[model samples]
Target: MLHTNHAKHRMPVVTAVRLAAMYEDDRMLRSIRDLAPRPEEPLSVGEVIAQTPIGTKVPVTLFPTVGINRPGTDRWPVLIQGLEEIAHWVRTQAVPRLITGTEPPEPGLPMRYEISVGHEDERQAMSAGSTTSAGERHKKALAAASARGDLAEMISMIDGSPSEPQIARWLAQLNHEEVLERMSPLRMAFDYDPEVERHNFEVLKGCRDAALRFGDSDGPHEK
Candidate 1:
């Protein structure tokens, strides 16, 4: 399903601008001690990092609003490049986790969810439905509806019920994931990241094999 939740809770415009400003102006990052919510109180660099929308998938337009205040005509590209550098740093350095004091879940715990990409609405559902049966049901319903509409459209074209272009324009006006969604008249039926998951699985398997070979001594470590 498409994930749309992020659209509603987008990072605030001011926060995006400030973070973009920090990236565009080295002096701002260097003089981080001066950042504050008000005139008298000083905010630490870590605090700023916590407040910044590190993981937010905000719109690109926010960058231009921040860049217009700066000196050069080339500010947009420079800001983009700088933001990329910062994102790289955030991922590798684990800066977001450090500042937020959040940690990865214990590997022993059951796999709660899997990462998949979809449209905005689907994304929203995935986030809200995490580890919940009801969420899964909703997802399936949406998928089934979408499939039905697709099958219906294909059948209509094959049967010569209407011109393809006419059907397409009608479908567009319905403005839904599947024409059935808004029209309600149609009916129908219908990688894992190997580098990370596969690598982890292999390591675990190797450890298990070695523990079995060593018996009691190495078995405890496997646990």
Candidate 2:
């Protein structure tokens, strides 16, 4: 009787066939697998759905197949576009959902997360210009405008010798009600000169009614 090693001989062919099947399956899976989320860092499912090009550093997965359910291809543009759309939606329809007690739609839904990524080059350039030089500080004071609310007083302090016109502009930008509530009698005492006192008093009176409207609440004042 010839002792044939049938099991050993059959093993190679069987392994080859299994490998070939696996390769085919992987190829088929490639289409849908490409669509699956490929985040740079591991994120929760909700985070993965919400991420946008601006905020998150994750890539989007795209499933292009109709029904076979294969793996998707990684797509960046699609993710970006989706994020933009979601941002728009949030700005418009989602405001109510956010502010009001209305329940938001289902969680884990494929919504885009929009994030603003700052440009390092632009930031460096801005930092170069942002040094607090005397001239730069002056310019910042002017730019700060009374529009900045309570910070206007700080801007005035920084400005040192701000002109009457500049002061007026800053005061003009302030909320009328806030101006009245913050302008205390002590603030009036700062000017000992009769002429300056008269001018400041008039300005305060002019703004008093508006301040009265705010009801004298202890809140942030123009400082």
lDDT of each: 0.37, 0.38
TM-scores, one per candidate: 0.18, 0.18
What would the per-residue lDDT of candidate 1 be over residues 94-164, giving only the tens digit for each residue? 54467557763222122134546455575455445433333344555666557445533553434223433
Candidate 2 residue-wise lDDT at 158 = 34
lDDT per residue as tens, model 2, 1-223 = 1113552244332110010011222233433334444333222333323434575554433322111111132222232333345454564456648766576543312222223554558634433442223334444454444334433343343323243334445466565444444453313343268876666556444444333333235343342
Q: Determine which window of 10 residues in candidate 1 has minimal summed lDDT.
A: 61-70
Clashes of 1: 14
Residue 22 in model 2: shift from native, Å?
88
Residue 127 alpha-carbon offset, candidate 1, angstroms:
8.0
TM-score of candidate 2 to 2 decimals:
0.18
What would you estimate as the lDDT of candidate 2? 0.38
